[model samples]
Target: MVNWFWKRKRPLTRTLRVRSRGDYGDVRRVDFAELAPEIDTYLGQAAYLQLGFFETLSDLIAPTPELSQKESLSLAAGAALLKHRALVDVIRERGDDPLDVMLPFREPLDTFRRATHGARPLETMLSVQITAGMLDDFYLALSASYGATGKQVAEILQADDDRDALVSILKDAIDSDPEWSSLLALWGRRLVGDTLLIARAALGSQALDEEEEARVDPVFTDLLGAHSRRMAQLGLDA
Candidate 1:
């Protein structure tokens, strides 16, 4: 039932650069103190969105003993809440108003959610997964561009416990209904596309270099590769 949409002919490891020291040589160093407000803005909105998504997911999943004991849906929701609080804490520590920091991004994030509303729990989970993974890549890519605090926030935002739980649920769902593989695969693709569009719009508003913009396509290709691998792991076609 695994239908691969495309296969990468060559490896992409070298194509997509992470936080390598060499890449930072010519790049202008972003002052953490100056950038802290914007950083908090980004993370706060992200934390709010993720927490809401996890809360909705917690309500959607059936309370089976296996799911209850192992995944503990409430734990995922709680984790997301805590992450939001932590983001707020980061903002407060920087002496910024958390509400003001997150206010600008609220509209775009809401619009994204409204535009990409899923019809099923599986699709919802996949959307979360795609967004989470892409954000991780984006943060990691830009980690060195900012200062040490930026790196710290990037690492903090990279937590994937809730996403991991969603993945387990997705795998189990696919296993139970192999016939849904094709549909789910299509959903995954849609999620990836929508996520990228939203990300582009969001990050485009930031001050990025021409070099960074040029590097986006290759990094996105790497994201697709990672998404494909994740789909394959769930016995779905990429």
Candidate 2:
């Protein structure tokens, strides 16, 4: 979680904060005092202009799944932050295929980008951590409901000494909520755990926090259900 990055010039000729994050909530703390100009500079780039693509994606989502558009956007925004922020160096260190690893949730992402993101560029959107928090809350609820219990779900929040024990405590969060979980067809494995990995990083990064239990955003659940349904058409195991 280092915060010292080699300041490479941006292709867009914009200056965005190249944050060096640590394991603690140690990202370059939200420094509004020093950020306005930098954020504006990043937003001024052509990449920012491409955010209109999300509007088109929004239309593609139709009524926008079971989650409210806001909720979906929250989740999507989290996903974006994970990609752009989070434990980025480790991901890069692994030399993992970003497309294969992260883009599995493309449908939802594309839908989210189209619906939200407006004229903000990716660099600008990801520079701030508050937005990542919004997304973190959205991801925890969405991922846990898929039937992963507390023990399996513990990493979403704290770092437990006995991860196995904490996972046991987390079963409720993963098991009882059928709202979003019902839409997911859990088999023996996941074709897309990286989506959740992004969320875990967001949670650890303090970019997300949990909402009250029983707060099931129906719009999101329905959308997830729709996402699950469509997967069946391709004969892909849900």
Candidate 3:
């Protein structure tokens, strides 16, 4: 298990603009030196995280009884695997062995996967949608720091996740049983802490000094805002 620690300081009122090129064909960019990691660190973590999502989604397929649902899960799983492979190509183009770059992150991220896995399949499905959405946004924000390579990564992250099926599946679950509405909502809320910790940890530190925190705060704020919108889209309270 990954031990989690978070400290809340008073929010700072500031506007930081990040131009995102890959999301919805928007070609804008911003660089954050204080929060960005070395290029290898960023690439390795992003690649492995996508691979992890693929593995989780793949695991969900067999036990799922409905053929149409299985097909939907396969699409989402394939998208995740495609993103993972695309990231690996980026790593290879840099002349680094993909495994060498990705190895260090395996244990911690696997721990993160386990920690976020839920008691039921629906809870786990929401975990993939929410965590993947937030982290994909986080990495896209960090992509600007790496210039052209970052742009390529941004494009990869922005690819269609085909996770809308998961959303419809969840919404149906909630609508079918009023009980699922509260259960999944609570699961969604519980996910934020662990998910944020994974995002924070990817910055190459378990702890950040106050100055670093200040610079990183707005990016995370944006992540949380996107997260809430995703939860609401599922008809659940964030």
Q: List the residue pairs that clash in candidate 3.
A: none
The TM-score, computed over Cα atoms with residue i paired to residue i, of candidate 3 is 0.89
Which one wins on TM-score?
Answer: 3
For candidate 3, write residues 1-238 as lDDT tens digits.
Answer: 3564422222122122354423322333333454456677788989999999999999999988889999999999999999999999999999999999899888878888998898889999999999998888888877766768988998998889999899999998898999999999999999999899888876655677887787777677777777888898999999
The C-alpha TM-scores of every prediction are 0.72, 0.22, 0.89
Which of the numbered candidates is closest to the native, going by highest lDDT?
A: 3
Error of 3 at 133 (Å): 0.3
Candidate 3: segments with Cα more than 4 A from true spot: 4-31
Model 2 lDDT-worst window of ten? 1-10
lDDT for 101 (candidate 3): 87
What are the runs in model 1 whose C-alpha is more than 4 Å off? 1-41, 61-71, 205-213
The digit string of per-residue lDDT tens for model 1 on 1-238 reads 1111211122112222344221121222322212222455445655666656565556555734464534555666666666677667777887888787777666666666655556876676676666656655555554544466565666666564455676777787888988677888888777776676655543423454566565565555655676677777678777
lDDT of 2 by residue, 110-153 (tens): 44333333232211122112222223323323323223222132
| Candidate 2 CA-lDDT value | 0.28
Clashes of each: 2, 26, 0
User: Which lDDT value does model 3 have at 104?
Assistant: 81
lDDT head-to-head 2 vs 3, winner = 3
